[model samples]
Target: MKKVIAIYPGSFDPPTNGHLDLIERGSKIFDELIVAILRNPDKNPLFSLGERRAMLEALTADFKNVRVDVFDGLTVDYAARVKAGAVLRGIRALSDYEYELQMAMMNRKLQPDLETVFMMPAEQYSYLSSRLVREVAKLGGSIQDLVPEMVERRLREKLDPAIKLQDARKMKPGKRA
Candidate 1:
């Protein structure tokens, strides 16, 4: 019997809880689940590709069936190259469905053998997204619940340098400024 392989490709700027939820679920369904980071130079990502890959690796380390990887070019092409039977995507809302449906149709046309599987995150994470997490972190808002602690730390460190300064200032009440 052939092993089932699936590719979950995304920019994963900061891999939010929604992404992790999908990864966790996908890992169980496929014999091997590759969580691929799209290497798009045009995107001004808050987390570098390496950083994102590292966090995913750390986060999914417990899942023996899941692996973290990076890929460039079209997702369908990448899926074909990796011999993935399907492409996994998470749809959080109607807007996401419209866009993803179009992309899935196109991918189906491009690679007749490959399939697109859309899954919805748990209700608690339905509204979470990497872009939203980055925006919240950029504005120095708490992202403790949005992403993993490691990712949260990195996001704050990369997006808001002043957070550290403010924290230090708070630690020394007398040196307020």
Candidate 2:
């Protein structure tokens, strides 16, 4: 029997609960699920590649069929290199669907044999996103429910220093305000 391998590629910059939800589900469907983190230089990510990789590795440690990896360049290219049979993606809403659909079509064009599988995360995380989680954490909002505990801790450790610096800059130098 042929082993079914699927690649779930994303930035995963401080992976949120929504991402984990998909990974958990994808793991069950494929013989092996590779959570590939894209090393995108175009966008300024909150977490470093190593940090993101560590977080994902830790989060998915218990999943026997799941593994985490970092990749550069095109997802389809990486998928092909890894010999993945399919690419797993999460669709949160219409906006996401439109974007994903275009990418999936292009991926199909790029790799004729590789298939794209779209799955929706649980209803509770339909609106959850890594960007939103970062935004909320940046503004001193709680993200306990949006991410795993380890991720939440890492977010605080990563963001709190900058937040504290900002707070310090706002305070009067010699006055106890």
* Candidate 1 runs further than 4 Å off: 165-177
* Candidate 2 residue lDDT tens string, 1-177: 999999999999889999999999999999999999998889899999999999999999999999999999989899988999999999999989888999999999988899999999999999999999888778766677889999988887889875565456558587442
TM-scores for every candidate against the unseen true structure: 0.90, 0.90
Worst 10 residues of 2 by lDDT: 161-170
Candidate 2, superposed: residue stretches over 4 Å from native? 161-177
lDDT of 1 by residue, 117-166 (tens): 99999998988988888776666566777898888788666756756754
Q: List the residue pairs that clash in candidate 1.
A: none
Deviation of model 2 at 87, angstroms: 0.3
lDDT of each: 0.88, 0.91
